[model samples]
Target chain A: MALADARALVPHLPAFPHDPAGDGAMLMRAVEACERYTPMVAPDGEDALVLDLTGCFEGQGWTRETIARDALAHLARMGLGGRAAHGPTPDAALALARFGMDELADLPVAALALGAEADLALRRAGLRTIGALAARPRAPLAARFGRELPVRLARLLGEEDRRITPHRPAGAIRAERRFAEPLASVAPLLDVIEGLAQRLESVLARRGEGGRRFDVALFRTDGHVARLAVACGRPLRDPPAIRRLFSERLESLSDPLDPGFGYDMARMAVPLAERLENEQRDLACGEGGEAQPDLAPLLDRLAVRFGPDRIRRFHPRDEHLPEYAARPVPPESGPAAWPRPEPGEPPLRPLFLYDPPRPVGVVAEVPDGPPRRFVWRGKHHRVVRHEGPERIAYPWWKHPEGRGPTRDYYRVEDEMGQRFWLFRHGLYASESDHPQWYLHGLFA
Target chain B: MTDSPILRLGSRALSAPVPKGRGVIGLDVPEVDRWLKGGLRRDGLHEFYAPSGSPPGPAMALALLAGMRNCGQGRSLMWLRARGGRRKDGPHAPGLAELGIDPAALLLLELADPADLLVAGVESLRHGGAGAVVLELRGRCRALDLTASRRLALAAERSGTMALIVRGDARPVPSAAHTRWQVSAAPSRALPANAPGHPVFDLQLLRQRGGAEGLHVQLEWNREQAVFRTPIYGDPPAVPAGRAEDRRARRAA
Candidate 1:
C-alpha cells in the first residue's frame, strides 16, 4: 500500500522512505562493532547477523544465554532493537528468534520466511502450524510448494547441518586487556602492549613456534576501532624485539594516533605462526670470534619505519639491456651469488649512467672518428683524448619494435678534467645520415 | 751528558719518536701517499666538492671508494643520497659494477629527508661493519651544519670507518671535515689517437687539518693496475708534435 493511503486510513501514522544503501552501510558498521564480542560475526541478509560463539567465550565466565543478552544490550545502547536466540545451528537460531518454542510443534508457518503464496496455500490446505505441516505427506507438500520448504524445515528442526562464514579471520591465539578507566596516553598503551607481548611470547614458546604476524585491535569508547599490524621478517618470539618494532611503526606513521575519548579495551593476537628452534650459542671465544652481523633486527626496524617496498636489495639480472641488467627484490630473498668485477681492475664502465641517455651536442671528425669536443648542459669542453666506438647491437629478438639501432659508445675526457660516456644512436653510413649523439654515463 | 747512562738513554728516547700508523690509509703511490700525511685519514671526515654544474665530485668519490673497497676485503660500504637529489636515472648496478665495486658489498640508501642523509651516514659509520660510508648531497643542505659534521667525524673516529661526503657546486663552508678536496676533470692522455684514455683528475687539496694545503696533483687511474698514477709528462704532453711527423713520414714511404 502507498504511504498516502495508509496515512489516510489512520490519521496518525508514521512512515519513512526505504533506503537500502544507507541500511547496508549501517549493517557493515554493526558487523565491525560486533567484532568485540567475537571475530566470527557474519551479516545474515539485511536484518540479521550470525556469530559462531562456540569457543569465543571460553574462560570468559559467560554462558551462551548471558552472552546473547549482552550482545542485544550492546546493540540496544547503539539505538537498535535486536532479538537473539541460541541453537546448534544458524537456521535453528534464526527460526527460534521469530517463533516461540514453548509449544515446539505449534509455531506458525509464517516464521519460515517462505513466500506469501506458499503460506496462503498451506493455510488453504489446513496446514496452519508446523505440527500440521509435519503430519502431511512430504512428497505432495514438496511438489505443491517447491522443494525449498522441506529443506528449510529440516534445517530449522535440527535435522540438517548449517554453517556461517565469518567476516574476518578468527585469531588463533589472542590476549585482551580491559581497563576500568580508558587509556588516554601512549605510555600506558605501550606498557599494556609489552605485557601482552610477554604473555604471547610464553604461549608461542610452549608450542615451539613463533608469530610471523601480530595485530593489535584498539576499541575506543566512542565506537571507533583502530588496528595496528606488524609483520616479522622471520618467526619472532622475543618480546623486546616485538615491542621495539611496534615503537618504530608507531613513530613513523604519517597520521599520528589520536585518542579522541580514550581506548576502553585493547586486544593483541597472532594470526600467523611458524616453527622455530633455538640455536646453541658459542660460549668459548664468544667475545671476538663470533663476527656474524645480525642484520635481521636492523632490517625489521627499517622495514617497519619505511615500508618494505622502500628497502630492497639489488639483484644482477642475466640480460644485456641496461635497465634490465639489475632488479630490486625484497631483502634476504635475492640470490646468494651476485656478479662481481675482476680483482684489482680499473673500472671499465662509468660510475654513473643516465637511463634513456641524455642528449648532448657532439663535434666529431667525419665518418666514425670519436668526438673531438662535446657541449653538455650548455658547457663547452675540448676533448683532449677519447676512446671507443665500442659497438653494441640491439637485441632484435627480444624487442620486436625494432625502433632502436646499434650504438657506438665512446669515453671522452674534456679539458675540465671530467670524463663522460657518450654514444651515437646509429651508424653514419648504414643506419642514418644524421646519427644523434647522447651522453650516456659519467666516469668518475 | 755522557756521565750518567740514564740521562743519555732519556735523551735518545726523546730524539727518536715511534713510527705511528694511526688515521692513515695507503694509496700505494709514493708521491701522493707521502703528500697526504701517509694517506687518506680513516678517522675523520673527507669532503669532495666540485663547482656547480660540474659532475666530477661523484667521480672522485667513487675512485676513492674503489681504492678503499680493495683495501678492506671483508668490510662493506654504505652509500647514501638525498631522496630529493636522486634522479630516476642516478646510479645503476651494472655501471657501479664496471667501476670495480662489488654490488653486494655496497648498501645504497636513498633517504627521504636531506637531514636523514647525515643521520644515516653517522649511523653507518657507527655500525662498524662498513669500511667506509659515502654521503652525496647536491647543492647545499642546511641540516648538514658544523655540528652534524662534528658528530659524523666523532663517529668515524670512534668506529675507524672512513667518512666521505660529496657536495656539488657549493662554496666551502665551516665544517669538521679533516680534509677538503676540489676535484675537476682534466684532459686525458692521447695514447691511441681520438680514443679516450684512463680517467684524469686535477685534485686540489684545499684544506687539511694540521697539514699543508693548496697542494695540487694530476692523478691518473690505471684500470689495469687498479691504482692511481701521476702522469709522467704532467699535462699537455708536449703538444704531440712527434706523432704528426711520424704520420707524415709513413705516408711519404
Candidate 2:
C-alpha cells in the first residue's frame, strides 16, 4: 500500500496524451502563458515547465507553496492535467510530484526510485513514505544506493536543502508592479509603464547595460492578459527614449485593454539585452551637438502608424553611374555611416539626389563634349559654359550584360545660371547597344 | 534775462553727448575692413573667393584664424567640410595656435555632405557662443547666396559669432556680406643684403567702400611673430605713377 506500488499497478502512462491538437502543442501554449509572470520560463520536459520565480514570487506576494498550488490550479483551469511540487532540486520535485504524493506520513525508501539497486534495497528494508525513509539510518541507504541516494532523499524531504538555479537568457532585465486594486484606463497604465521603464533605466545605467528588445505585459482580471513588444535599432537606456519607442507600440494594439475590468498587475521584461558605453559630446565648435539625430523612435512611430516599410534610409550601391548610386533601406537596419563617392573625382554632382537618374534627349552627335541644347521634361535649355567628358566606366567584371557604356559627365551652366550635371550613358567605343543620354543631377 | 542761464546749461548738455568710436581693429577699413567686418562681424558672413584649381595655403588659413580669435573666450571655432588638404598635408593645429588661436578650441567636421555642412552652420549660428565657422566647398557658392547669407548674418548677430565661407574661383557673388575678398598668391619678396628678409605680399585691396581702389601696398608677414606690418624701404622708392589708371583701363577691356 505504497505510492510507488499504487503508480505501478495503474500501468505506465505515455509522456503526453493524444488530443485533437496534440498534448505537446497544448503544453507549449501553457508554457507561453507562464511568460505573463516571467520571461525566464523554460520547458523542463515534454509535459512540464521550470519557472525561475525567485524574483517573481516576492512581487506576487505569494509563498513558494502558494505559487506552486496556484500554478497547478492555472494548469487545471486550462484543462491540462498536471501535478505540482515545491522542492529544492528539479529531479526531486519531479519525483515527488510523480511518485511520492500519497502516504505523506510514511517516510518510505521503497516508494522513491533510486534506480534498480536502491529499489531492491528499499524492498528488503520494508520502508515507505518520505518521512519514514528519512528517519531510518542514512548509513545503510548510502551503502546500498551509494552517497547520491541519501543526499537526494534529504533534499526531497526539505532537510539538507538544494537550490534550483534558473537559466537566465542573455541581455535580460525585468521590472514589475502589483496593484492594490484592478486598474483601468490608458493614462494610469501609461504611468505604471513609465515607472517600470524608469526602474529598468536605473538598473541598466548602474550595470552599464541597455535593452534592445522589451516586452510589457498586463495581467488582467479573470486571468485575461494583454502584452506589447518593441524592438530598437540600438540598445538604449534613456527613460524618455524607452518611453518614446513604447508609446508608438502602445498605440498600435487592437482590442486594447479597455480595462474591461482592469489589470491587476503590469511588468516589463528585457529578453535581449546589451551593454552600452556612456556617450560624451565634444565642446569644440559645437560639432558634438551636431551628431545625427536618433532615428529609431521616428522609425518606430512610422512603423506603428504606417506599416514597417514607410520609414527608410538611402544606401548607395557600389556603382559609378549616378542613377545606381543609392537605394532605400529600412530605417531600423543600416550601417553607422552613409557611403560616399571616391575622392579626387570631378563630376558635377547634385545636392538633392534622385533615386534613378532621369533620362533626357540630346541633339549632340557622338564624340561630343556635351550637348549645347537638350530638352528635358518638355522644357528646352541652352547650355552656355560647358566642362567635362569625365569618363566613368561600369564594373564589367560584376555585370555580364556589362553596364552598357562608359559615361561622359559634364558640368554645364545655362544662360539662367542654372547648372546641370548631365551624362551620356553609353560611349562610341562600346558597340553592343545604342548609346543613351541622361540628366543625372542638378547643382545648386 | 532770468531764463538765459538755464537755456545755456540745457544746450551745453545736449551738445556734449558721448561720441562712440569708429570700429574695431581689422574691422573698420574699406576693401580690407569691409570683408574683415563681414568676416569679423560680432556675427556676420564673410566669403572668400580663391582662384579655381589652386588649393588654400597656410598663410591664408592663418590670416583667417587671426580674425576668428578676436571674437571672445571659450568660443568654439568649427571647420566644417575640410577639402584639398589632409591633416598632415597642411599646418593645421600649430598654425592656428601660432596666430594666438587655441587649437584645442577648434572642431574639425569632416562631413562629405554639403547639406550637413549647411545645417551645422545654421545650427551653430543660431546657438551662438561658438567662436567662428569655416566651411570649405570644392565647387561654387551657388547653393549659398544673399538670402541664406542674410539669414546666417542675423543668426550670427543674435549669437554674437561669425561665418567664413571659403570657396573655389567659380563662386557666385555673395550679396549679404559687408564685403567680399578674392585672395591670390602675391609676388614673393626679393632678398636683401646682410639680413635674412621675410616674405612680403603684393596685396591688391580689391573691392572696398568709399572707392579705396589700389594695389600699391606691400605687406610683410612676420611668420615667427604672427604680425602683418608695412615693410620699410631703405630710401624713398621710385613711384609708378598712374599705374592705378592703367590697371582700370585694362580691367574695362
lDDT of 1 by residue, A1-444 (tens): 988899889979987789999898777767766777788889888888888787877777768888788677667756677888877778777767657463435677876679899889888978888777767777887899989889877776677878788888888787888788988876677778888899998888888998888898887665567888888778888988888888877887788888877887888899999898887766774676435344566556666776665555567888765656778676657334565554433344777767768998888877577888788888898877566666777888787886577889887777665778888988898898889999888777
Q: What share of the reference contacts survives in each candidate?
A: 0.52, 0.00
Q: Whole-model Cα lDDT per candidate?
A: 0.71, 0.56
DockQ, each predicted model: 0.30, 0.02
Report model 2's interface C-alpha RMSD after superposition on the true interface residues.
17.6
CAPRI tier for the interface of model 2: incorrect
Model 2 agreement with the true structure over A59-168: per-residue lDDT tens digits: 46788777777676767766777777645555556665666363344534543557777777666777545666767898987886688877777666656644433333
**TM-score against truth, every candidate:** 0.83, 0.46
Summing lDDT over every window of 10 consecutive residues in candidate 1 chain A, give the lowest-scoring window.
Answer: A339-348
- lDDT, candidate 1, residue A127? 83
